[model samples]
Target: MNFFSKETKTALQAKEAALQLAFAPVAFQATRALRNLGILKIISDAGRAGISLEDIVAQLTLSKYAVRVLLEAGLGIELLLVNDKKYTLSKMGYFIEYDELTRINMDFTQDICYRGMDHLEEALITGKPAGLRELGPWETIYPGLSLLPPDIGKSWFDFDHYYSDIAYPQVLPVVFASKPRQLLELGGNTGKWALACTGYDPDVQVTILDLPGQMGIATQKIKAAGLEHRVSFFTTDVLNENLPFPDGKFDAIWMSQFLDCFSEAQIIAILQRCMASLADGGRIYILEPFWDRQVFKSAAYCLQQTSLYFTAMANGNSQMYHSDDLIACITAAGLTVISQNDQMGMSYTLLQCVIK
Candidate 1:
């Protein structure tokens, strides 16, 4: 009766993969070294003919000894193929070298997660963003976004927008369907959605609600676009139970990649406050990458790992939710799920809800 079953003829391969996981940290460092030293590029340029270790050393300006060690590691990791003493990039290596998603994930991991992930155990125990202290003294990561090192901040924002920006197009039409006059962008990081909204319709006024630090960045970006007259910012931390939702009964509220940053109880509270503030007939548009809703196993795997970032560096108690759990929150908050738009770019799911 079990619907799930798979052949175990690949059992040996599974064990080998598990072994790879055990040495993954070192393998990751080696791959990073390969990328930074242009070893991958050299091997890739060599193409199917491959490049000898000496040639790799000559091209990358590295010592022969370093080249041998890194190349052997890459071979073991399957990032390189060695034949007749020449090395070539594997298919995986090609993606690591040129894929935009791979670049974003690598940069995000190195800049935002590497050190912080070490504190994951402590974060889990305390139910707080313990690793955020690595970046600053702030209790949470949001307030310190503006203070992060320039390169790290760039990686962080790149990872953030890369996913949401792609979904904006699909969501914009659904949001403006009723032709909302006043739209509230909850947790509008860097004012991307707000800018898009105002640009889509000059008549639609946009107000952003986020932490003061984030609002500062959002305000600058909105002003730079010369849409300041149509867009505004309100400072508030949703985690603060006392900070009620904006009094502005906006005709629409947009929360993209926002609710996943909080625990279920916090999500319920936020939704309730949103329902109270939302005007009659207005809808709350929720954009999230629900792992359980992902069609590809690789996408689900990636999202499952991203949840750890929440545990270690972001808020400790939140994660990439399952669609079922999110729907539960909506229902518990006295809201209706009018429809769910799936297949959004980057495996995102948009849930459109209105007050019950």
Candidate 2:
């Protein structure tokens, strides 16, 4: 069944939804302020009895006016419930305060994507990442990733790794089941998966193909993990179709949360290259969170919103894809999906393919 086949809201509900959309930014900032200012924690600690605005103000250095304004906003945002002049954390507030995923997503949106998102309209018109100027001078964000401010870089990688890392344990067994000794990982950011693969199979030799800056970080991580000998690095821009991939056949190729970083054309080009590099009978594993394949509407909503980030900040092209669109790219690249595993971790779908 189509997840959004029918309208579920009534006229009043639809109007309220429209109002929520209009005030989304205000609610977002208010919620973030409540969490960051430790107000949510104070209310949570107060337990079932809740606490008064005066008590909340007494616990923090913020003025009563400041605390009161945010608490009122929080009430409207549904992050807090107030009764008899007391405030208590709501279920939504709990997630905002303590959920790791929520924290990571919020931080990433604030630090990396917020300012640049202002240029989204311009980027859409120009077909370029106009908002990237907020960070550094680059056509796209990839080359400047390593050079990002420490806090920004941390948020970026935290968001990137969180989704993929959760699926590693479940996917490792699937990829290693065939016992591919010569494994190649495209866009092997920070060597996380390479490390996992080497640790999983002692005899396996892995190669990481990525841009030079990412290669540096991955190289350091591999060496720090004492797996340098088992892991090799191939530093080059994978988007540059003029440059050929390393001349070698692999038993299996793995790309985790990688292909979504490219546009449809680029994905097809990269896959075609992978097709050329695949050994006879070798398999290619692609792990992605296709929005349409999501089990929940919320997951699909998040993926769809992330596409705008690509428009304004990351690159003016690539996006979190729908499954059918991605599969079309696969077929265009002359490869066929032999197996597909959904709901691996979070919202990810792992596609196991072979040359057509």
Candidate 3:
């Protein structure tokens, strides 16, 4: 069942894969152009009848050459099928054009990662987010997340929230199984989870611990929700080892897609802090899309590729971790993974841990 344990392609097939990689960027841009320029929509609207390059050009007010080149590239990318000088949308094209998940991933890639990815090699060499400079003057993306251009910021948050949002409803019951009165949510971006927690249980008091900028955004949402009395904010750089977590005994500490944003050592340090802050019988829950635990190969592939984005654009020291590696971090921090539930909403793994 190990999909990647052995080579399945013939030599010629492997060579073709190599060539695809060589021109992958060109293919990506061409596909984006086809979608953005309305070519894919026109062909999709044409249904089985398909649409001709001439018709596409006429409808879009683009030059014949421009439409033709992109349509031809679309053909090469297997996103289109041409017959009798007319183009039809392939299954892949349909997904690219209309699928919500695909749309979010495409927008995220284009708006947030495409240009910054050029510095990936430098980031690997320097152990720093060299590509982050493409976005703004920040050592890491977290601090500048709120300051990103509106469109870019939208794509980033959309990408971040899409996976976690799918898992929130499922995780709520798991976290509240103990009916804990106090919950601490780390990396509480925009306060979405905080809102979910407060809404799920009116009696549960939630504290969102995050950086100031993220706290600002979350604070607004908390106030707007009129849950200001039930929800509180704690702003600090989590990586500042000197500044330990605020003095409080939290009944449950929740980190959703948060630990993966830090290096292995940082994860251990953060987990240690969580241990220190836990009340009697308190537990820590970590929800992440650990690549190694994904049920589908496609999900694993997507997670693996997302790690590159972390290297180039997020914090270079962090990645979408393997399950084993992450578990090791927990053990190293003097915690025991009492329960691990995999295949949760959208290929995520929920690890329930207790102090050792």
Candidate 4:
């Protein structure tokens, strides 16, 4: 199949876009300053009438000169509008200040990615997470999530939870559609999805499979939620081919925002393993943000840029995939796509597959 569609622009527009990319750092900092200095919130609170420059400086306790320069920079970035020497929040600026998705993305980019991204080139060349050294001594971020300094770990979890949590409510019903007696959750970080599964269907037994270190956290959450009996744990590297799933069969396997964390070969191995453990008529449900299936260019742009984060910080080999590419991997693993659910909450797509 041909590659999925993308928005295109003329040469002049593309040139302007290139210039914007070149100055992205300046814009990033300016946007942060607008929020940090209370400039954006102040204008947003003032409504359409806007707020005068003097009021912004006075409320923020900053020198007029500094405030003026920042406001001008904000204007250049299209985050603000100035009229009659008063400022108002632009659509982008309002979203920056208020939207949960924007806030989570901003904090994640600023706290987790900003510095590590500097080594993106080195990572791409070596095919390793070269930037991981900036945060901790680990081959990848997953193994060291618990050991990361408290603030850094919070940033990581916040970024991770924010994305999946928003989509879980909508995803829960879809996964329960088959009403399977036993459900196996792969990459069950922190046990949120497993907990949700048990909560969704009290009779359904869940076995969560992930690394031991990650299981440490997920186990705690399971116990805390009083789900220890319903939600079981299976700790494995997942890349280890020797030990796959348990002897017991699973009726439905759930992988939520998980496979994109691994390389293509790894994903295929994991799926092939699942195919071995799953009952003949069982299904595999995969929830992911496929860049090509996104409804908006901005969401797709975020997914593509997140691929760089994988290169530099998470794991070098894997990335957010387009639907066509990921489906190809599933087919290669001896699975057939039977149905799909897209636009669940935001950016997520659910693919339901069965044995080929």
Candidate 5:
């Protein structure tokens, strides 16, 4: 509040940042482990039963004392309750069950980030991933991803594909005035966005382009959506493969969460390819995370650092870019920025560019 003077505000912000710096990692690990324990209990109880401490010990293969400690801590955190020698999820814990956002966050922390955090020191030193330094990075992570059964990592992509699809109805009108045929959805997993877009415009032909494994999933999803007639899937490494389509083959291109994965040069290259592949004045819409200069010192900075750290660990490279950076990339690739809007109020920017 303005009632707090500027000096007080600055001091409070610094204090809060210090607290976050100290508490976030510990709290993150604790909550994630607790949530996993709760889920384990839920599943063990036929999905409708409460679990006793003994059950937790058996499921987690922990000593009785350790189980008690976990349960006590969990109860204190409101993830669990102590009642009649049994533990049950609290109402707040229901967010883990009922909210996709909560589940995705838990998954991200547990499956990807926790281990990556173990390598944070090495990452900071080399500006590369310690996990990759030891494990060969992208190659190891991607191929083994499908092999791992349905947990957070596998489910994350589903949410990614699904929520991006969910976002389309709201984003389309702002991004597109009239429908265009021949849509290319860059890095679209399982063709969700293509399906949504083609659903809105029956005449639109859609191609979903992504990595081979991702395209495999997209193919099945697109086929199941009954848009097979209008939609097709293409498995191509956008960075390595030559732009397969002829110049001006696409009327519109959609790249959601695609640019954030690349280095700056690669971003420029991809934008150039989009420019060449698009029809005259054809629009390209990009939805990617943003970290403007104004946000460089805000809580967004912490979020961005965490995102960057995980991305680097998982893939050896990732960057949170600003709208201006994107605009410059678009212009460098012979495209002009039409307009940009922050979607969902700064979660991401809906950026539109056209061939110059």
Candidate 6:
């Protein structure tokens, strides 16, 4: 301790500073670029056979210098190795190939996040979105999504897949254990949640309501799961439209990961509709992201902000609102929160409310 003096402490601090610089994007983008160019795909496909820089350059029409530069950068990032004349992707570079659950990291990054990031300062200044109008024409972007590069489509689908897997399993027990007979899933994407519920209890009958474009996926999955009789799909624009079911039709109404896609007024209107649709003792189970002051200052918050921005741009108006605001809305809509739990690392909350 006596030998450790102020100068040594200062030197140690400098060492720590140098280590953090290794995680910078400049240090990683080279490997990412190579993966984007299909070099990684060639290496992954070749396996023990290996590949050469000449093969990559010939296959991709990239210049030799460019290929060398990318490989060297990948080497620097530990994603590649240069053995004599050949350059091959390293084991770590194979990670994406095994990412089966998939996430929309790249699509959100390219379609919405990268551009929204450029306008973060504007969003802070106005307390409003910056890239809604600037988001590329929806008519052009959405219809062509399936035709976009495979990586892009996988990225988009992966995002939903990740959230669904992570968030839905935690909720299955709660929904089933509640012992509800008839269920209504509002804006349930592709009927994944409905299938889970019906699978858990043969007695449970579920109806899923979602956008017209998403109904096909829901119906196909529901029918394939052999729950066609118990689970059904209803295509309706929930934001600017009325509930398709009459009052007291469902024993439980599930609004998983859906209510966050609207403004406060819209959430309140939806809650009112849910109240009317519920059987007297029927409950509404809501799952949504609930933010606080700390979340407002995080990079993760930027994702939510960008999501709301793009959603409003694409669908007219959608948003992420506070849970307290929602509780208030539920109360005002004549529903009582019987129980509420926050899960999925507090990015989402589940509330079981009954008509009061």
Better of 1 and 6 by lDDT: 1
Clash pairs of candidate 2?
none
- lDDT per residue for candidate 5 within 159-199, as digits (tens), equals 35543455676777765575677888887765667767776
List TM-scores for all candidates, in order.
0.96, 0.98, 0.98, 0.93, 0.75, 0.67
lDDT of 6 by residue, 212-308 (tens): 6667666888778777889877667675554455446788898866766665677778888777778767788887666541233442464455455
Q: List runs of model 4 lying over 4 Å from the truth.
A: 1-10
Instruction: Score candidate 4 by lDDT.
Output: 0.87
Report residue 140 deviation for candidate 3 (angstroms): 0.6
lDDT of residue 84 for candidate 5: 68
Candidate 3, residue 104: how far the Cα is off, in Å: 1.2
Where model 1 places Cα greater than 4 Å from the true spot, the runs are 1-9
Prediction 5 global C-alpha lDDT: 0.65
CA displacement after TM-score superposition, residue 279 of candidate 1 (Å): 1.1
lDDT of 3: 0.91
**Model 3 per-residue lDDT tens digits across residues 56-103:** 888988899999889889998999999998899999999999998988
Q: What TM-score would you give candidate 5 relative to the actual structure?
A: 0.75
Rank order (by TM-score, best first):
3, 2, 1, 4, 5, 6
Question: What tens digits encode model 2's per-residue C-alpha lDDT throughout 186-237?
Answer: 9988889998998889999999999987787888898899987899988778
User: Tens-digit lDDT track for model 4 on 37-155?
Assistant: 78898999899999998888878888999889889989988999989988999998889898877877887888788999999999999999998888888888888888877877877
| Candidate 6 Cα deviation (angstroms), residue 80 | 7.4
Task: Tell me the lDDT of candidate 6.
Answer: 0.65
Error of 3 at 237 (Å): 0.8
Please write out the lDDT profile of model 1 over residues 148-254, one tens digit for every residue.
Answer: 88999999999989988998888888889899999988888888888889878879998898988888778888888898789987888888879877784789998
Winner of 1 and 4 under TM-score: 1
> What is each predicted model's overall lDDT from 0 to 1?
0.87, 0.91, 0.91, 0.87, 0.65, 0.65
